[model samples]
Target: MILPYPFPLDIQSILNNKNIFRRPPTRFGKMHHTITHPFHTPDQLPMTNQRINHEPVFLLASAPWRESSLWVEVFSRRYGRVALLARSARKRQSELRGVLVPFVPVSASWYGSQELKTLHRAEWIGGWPQPQGRALFSGLYINELMLKLTTREDPIPELYDALEAVMRAVCGENSHTAALRRFEWTLLNRLGFAPDLFHDGNDEAIRAEETYWLTPENAVVPIEEAERFNPRNHGVAVGGNILIQLREGDFTHPESLGQSLKITRLLIDNLLPEGIKSRQVLQQLQQFSFGV
Candidate 1:
């Protein structure tokens, strides 16, 4: 009969039977005691208890947990956002030290039925370059967006692909702003918060000469109609031409870039009641650079 929870098994017994080298104790002592049962081979454990192995993932964030462990958040191609407990990851010689880094792609394995899974293995898949400078900050902003907007275990493969593409674009010279705008738009669209750029709330096609305001309800209002709309529900004013440009995924125009940034930021802020920490950091960094 299947247990409601994962049955704890001895790591030593499983590893020994598989001839895998035993891990030494961590600095805190007795690290082996915290190591969970191994499922290196599918046949070693019952089919119901088999570990999910080598799933493609991108490390979003990590924090120190117990003495020699880490609490990690990863964006898996197959599993979306996942919370993983990486045992002994903080140890000096642990292989995970270099592997668990943001931006770079890696394959991760885990096993558990609980909300938090136990990380079994991770290996670097190494194709994309690690973003640096402003690009690095941009990458962090995207990570924060993912963490804030996505729920765990909800697979969004399209969003994952967009993230990878945006990261690459951000790393390229002169593409940071455009890449970020596109990514923000893509993310909002995928999450069902995208505003109707081509049409107004009345289902009227947007005219290039007309100005409109993007509403929190993901609708656009003509400026004249917006004046009559509830004052408390007002949105950021955007040019109809810019909205059409954004809908076409073109942010090459200076005005288009600025308007897109303001509009997307407003939408994202509306969704994230607690606000995005990384965005604040990014703004501070921008201010400091201007001051310098």
Candidate 2:
């Protein structure tokens, strides 16, 4: 349930500022919605090329803003993690209301300062199924990872593809543990933080019998040296079999998957700077719930 690290942006602060958003009145006093808007349009306000031509994005997590809007955090393919204020999507007849739901694909439109942006519109790309229970938890895990690693306005197209892939894997009948692991690993790599799994920086082959640890600098060293460099105690001396599997992007191997889980969780935990609410909920549920 514990976070690997602290987040740069104050998610708690943003959550506390939910008074600024407006949630629409519903029969049950709650309404669910998802919305997507494109990155550019002729109608958009004049702005620099940097802000005007952002790539299409996905809004992965959102909370009720106030009475009629949403405070959303999105994973943009070209813009990395973006915080936006989606206004008035909760009206009874609003198309955006139904389109703003999480785990669904949507292209978002936004403009603002280099920090937070204003969400102008959204359009759904209806091809994926909604996640439930454990799948929902897994989706949240992906969202959390994106928020933790990506910076605002930074592009990460590869992570976006990996994310879409995970969403597909989660919606299917199969358990998405392996898919999630690969996405996590890919995120770390795209962020320029993941350690090399196979060869050394000099391109020397890794010894199959030796155990090695991953450091932030992408260095693979003997287990003894790991303790000296691993400030967070999250590094592991993984088996070479797992390394080979990772090199091949093979998630089907049970041993490889297990190692991927261990190593990725460590790296993410160590690298994340802020608290993750969903991750904590997931851990508690996993520990206590058997029916799940």
Best model per lDDT:
1
- The digit string of per-residue lDDT tens for model 2 on 134-252 reads 78777777776675456555666788888888888887746888888888878766665566666654466877776777654356776656666647654567776677677667888
Off by over 4 Å in 1: 1-50, 286-292
Alpha carbon lDDT of residue 252, candidate 1? 84
Using all chains and alpha carbons, the TM-scores for the candidates as numbered come to: 0.77, 0.74
- Kindly report which residue stretches of model 2 are placed more than 4 angstroms away from their true locations once superposed: 1-56, 112-114, 201-203, 215-218, 223-234, 273-275, 286-292
What is the Å distance of residue 58 in model 1 from its true position?
1.3
lDDT of 2: 0.63
Candidate 2 global TM-score: 0.74
Clashing pairs in 1: none
* Count of backbone clashes, every candidate in sequence: 0, 32
lDDT (0-100) at residue 15 of candidate 2?
Answer: 60
| Cα-based lDDT at residue 19, candidate 2 | 37
